[model samples]
Target: MPTEAAFSWPREFVWGVSTSSYQIEGAVAEDGRAPSIWDTRCRMAGKIANGDSGDVACDHYHRYPQDVALMRELGIGAYRFSVAWPRVLPRGRGQVNEKGLDFYDRLIDAVLAAGIEPWLCLYHWDLPQALDDLGGWTNRDCAGWYADYAALIARRFGDRVQRWATFNEFSVFTLFGYAIDWSAPGVTDRDAHLRAIHHVNLAHGLGVGVLRDLLPQASIGAIHNRQVVWPEQDCDADRAAAALLDEHWNRAFPDPQLLGHYPPQIAAAIEPYVRGGDMATICRRLDWFGLNHYGPIFAKADPQCTWNFAWGEAPADAPRSALGWPTWPAAFRDELIDLSRRYRLPIYVTENGAGGSDSVGADGAVDDPARVAYLRDYTGALREALQAGADVRGYFVWSLLDNFEWGSGYGPRFGLVHVDYTTQQRTPKTSFGWYRAFIRDARG
Candidate 1:
């Protein structure tokens, strides 16, 4: 593999890291914050690995200043973080929590003081438990509720935050939470899944409009988790399964939001829920496309599953990450080129990193050669995509710290900085130094 010096990055290309609220901020019950659906899922037996929860993941709610300082030390140009909807709106709507809003104000101030730009993401799957009780995203009114929440965030943080993302990975939560019994407020019904899809898209469009109106100067976009879907076998059923999964996974959110209509397979089913001018309401102009690509996903037919498809395994000979995900940098390169051509918008690789089981060494240092190699190969592919006319503008690593990963819990560490869960001590990994140097060289 070529070294970092071999590739050239674009001028003004962004270099940063990202983290979500529930994954890191662990003041679950403090400051008048209410329960998100994930909070409720944590209490359910057998739902999460080791029965773990985000109750105190990274303790970032109380330790954000230290985290911000770490970003400055790494010379990161931008910091992408999400606001816990339940934290700001205790019931997900009506009655704002000043304390919750105040915490973010302090965080934003600290981030700016460190000379880093703040990119605020409106939602990161932490829907207030109160809202879930009222039908969650399945209900049509959920879109209005999300827009209201966006309005609150805009009015409070808009002055400081110029880059805003409406939602992070819209299809991931809706699919796992509604169609599969894998995530919070778990349900496995088709109608419920369709409703959630349309409602979330509607919410995103409405949120975009709100941000544009309230924060006219803000550069707004929505983050999507897109990946190539492949069949597990050569059989027709498996091929059919993969096709539908592709529509749901790759095109579901971006299609309606970008092209103003649902994909063919989803259009008929979702039409019932989409009222007059709902597509017009759900499609809004934006500044960029946030693409979160990890690795390609494999799907197989499953009669038992609600969607008639189940997650399949990658090829036996494929290179695998420590967490069992297939690691193929060519796919990353192709995805950027394809997304640029398909969307015709500036692309930002918002989340891309490898997860591993990392631990402090006998010498009190964390050595993660796999992560270092992964970053090198992936970033190299990013360069190839850019050179191929991908319209790529930026790339932000999946995370800065190993926080609570949903379902899999905290076992899979994706952080460039190692976090000692017991002591909350952050030790920069070998990849941390590598990324810092890569950023400096990329800028020059």
Candidate 2:
């Protein structure tokens, strides 16, 4: 059991919930919104489970006012949401979509009107199809294109949105989207994977520069899904394997953005696949580092792992999410300390939640005790890290509503509010009440 001491965080520690545009904002084809890579990918045969699409996801585009009301009632201090790139720049670049901008304008005002701060994430894996057609992240020119888009959005909305995130989970985009071929613009080529990672890192740094130039007072960072990596055994081979995995998965982006360099081992590993001058563009400074940590990974030496990557294993007895990810809050605290020591930048828990098989009880309540416990454990872990001297600043639960779950579609629920997709009804889960109380206590 976790302790509930008289622990208190700094008054300014942000407590909020997070959502992405594509995940919640339906109206995919409206307001000059062209197809994103996600849109195109979901329509492909056998791509998304249940053939689900975000065409009418959660209908947040239409019901944002209600959602803002929910946030106010929940007593959250801030909300972190992403801007859909395709919505603002229909063809990726060349023209502005006023209607699309108007949607966000109203949404931002609604959030502020409800007395809730709005944190904006510029990109959340919803790359415009036009950009993907032009080679996407694999193309070196994409870094410049993304920077221009960032400048445009920052210049337009930065006044109202004081906190900005350049990208959501950069490593996930490169790993699942390019290397593993599990996400949009999917391609399973190792060289493409390395190129995509470097280009995405460069795009983030360049985007930061643009945001800094445009919004001088705005706090900016990139959200990375970091994990504490450990060897499954004490053997030298397993330790070496774990080190290699850490160099790529853990140190790759943080070193570049925070320390102004990539880990030398990672640089050497991907050197032959790197294009000219990519590293220089990637190594830019950031004001803060956004970390989305859930659990640790137990890595073992696997000679057959791609790029000599270490194989990760979750103990059979460990609790698992609906997505089969292991639940390990202890690992979460360790990751926070490790990142604080390595980067020395204020960190935000940008996204952390567990998905489970949730159901609406006969009493008209969604009983999600598992999710409630998960949040409790993770929050305790976060507090532990703070007590241990991590420069932590905020926490944003993974989602506010259950919408499209990528390849899994709506099969997995990771929201405080349960959505009946068929009727478009929204109902807060038991975990929602617990979170509201948790926030109240934290604030107190």
Candidate 3:
């Protein structure tokens, strides 16, 4: 790793933290906020671990001023947070919730007043439950509904917020929710799975157009979660399986948006939904690329699997986060280099962090040396890519505080600051001090 005296980064490089609405803001039924698919999912028996829900998360909705103060103290240049879809449109369409909009307006102002730039994400898997009642993402009209919501928010706050992300991790929702029944609105149907992909692509492109027309000065992009996929065996069958998984997990989403067409492997499968002029609508030009990578995947051939590949289990000795995600720093650097070579857009490491089983000590310090080392190792690879001339403009840790971790509940913690879910107290972890000092020294 480079020392302080040997570091090289652009003067305007952004250091930030990312949080999704459903993951942190816990007021599920407050301020005219209608129920989201996640709320419904958490209520289903055997769906979540320990029967935990985001009903009271970190209570950030009621204590955002405190959260903003924490961000200001951390010395980050930006704060990326999502707008609750259900909060803004209680029924998903046809009516606006003024109270819901007021909440974000205040949140945005607080973030700006704290001297940090506000990066807005329009959707983060908290689809309004009412939309699920009407077919949700599988419905083709969802494209127009999302565009309408985008237009309303853009026309309201576009002047103050210059950066907007249309959606966050489309594959996680469609793959887990529609294909595997592991997430909200769970339905395991092959046809509905593919339909969700096409419709989300349409909604994103349409939302981009809406933002550009109403707020031409704004920067618009979508956050895509991608990683390298390696074959479990060197043989042709396993190689083909990994290729198929990569095509769907990695290339399928961005190819249509950036290259104006679907990958050849999936074109025939989704051709039924291809209408005239849809490609152009789905290929709207983005101002930048946002990547959310955890680690690479190893895939083995599996005929019974929906995608013809199954995630191979890691060896007993392999390094993993508390969440069991593999740790591969070299692959992280390669992802940056590959993305730079392929799309050549200004890149942002939008979501990168490791989850650990952290706890507050008797000394009142969260001495998570494991998490500190993880951040150091991962970011060392990031610096290597920067020196190799990747146009990386920003890097944001996966989160700011320990919040809800989806179906895993709150057991897996990925945060620079630790939050006591009971008392709602925020405690800065050891990594927080390391990052603050690193940014201070590097920016000097």
Candidate number with greatest lDDT? 1
Which candidate's TM-score is highest? 1
**Could you tell me which residue pairs clash in candidate 3?**
none
Error of 2 at 295 (Å): 1.6
> Residue by residue across 254-339, what tens digits does model 3's lDDT show?
88999899988889899998899999999998999999988888888987867767777655676887667888888999899889
Candidate 2 per-residue C-alpha lDDT over 1-444 given as tens digits, one digit per residue, 9 for 90 to 100: 235576787899999999999999999999799999999999898989999999999999999998999899889999999999999999999899999999999999999999999999999999999999999999988889999999889988888999999998887777778766679987877778888878888898789888877888888888888887778787888788888777777777778777766787767766776657666667666788898877777788876655555566776787776567888888898888988998888999999998977888889899988888889999988999998889999999988998898988989999999999888888999889999999888888
Per-model TM against the reference: 0.98, 0.94, 0.97
Clashes of 1: 0
User: Which ranges of candidate 1 are over 4 A from the true structure?
Assistant: 1-7
Q: List the residue pairs that clash in candidate 2.
A: none
Error of 2 at 115 (Å): 0.8
Worst 10 residues of 3 by lDDT: 1-10
TM-score of 2: 0.94
Q: Name the better of 1 and 2 by TM-score.
A: 1
- lDDT of model 2 at residue 314? 71
**Between candidates 1 and 3, which one is better according to lDDT?**
1
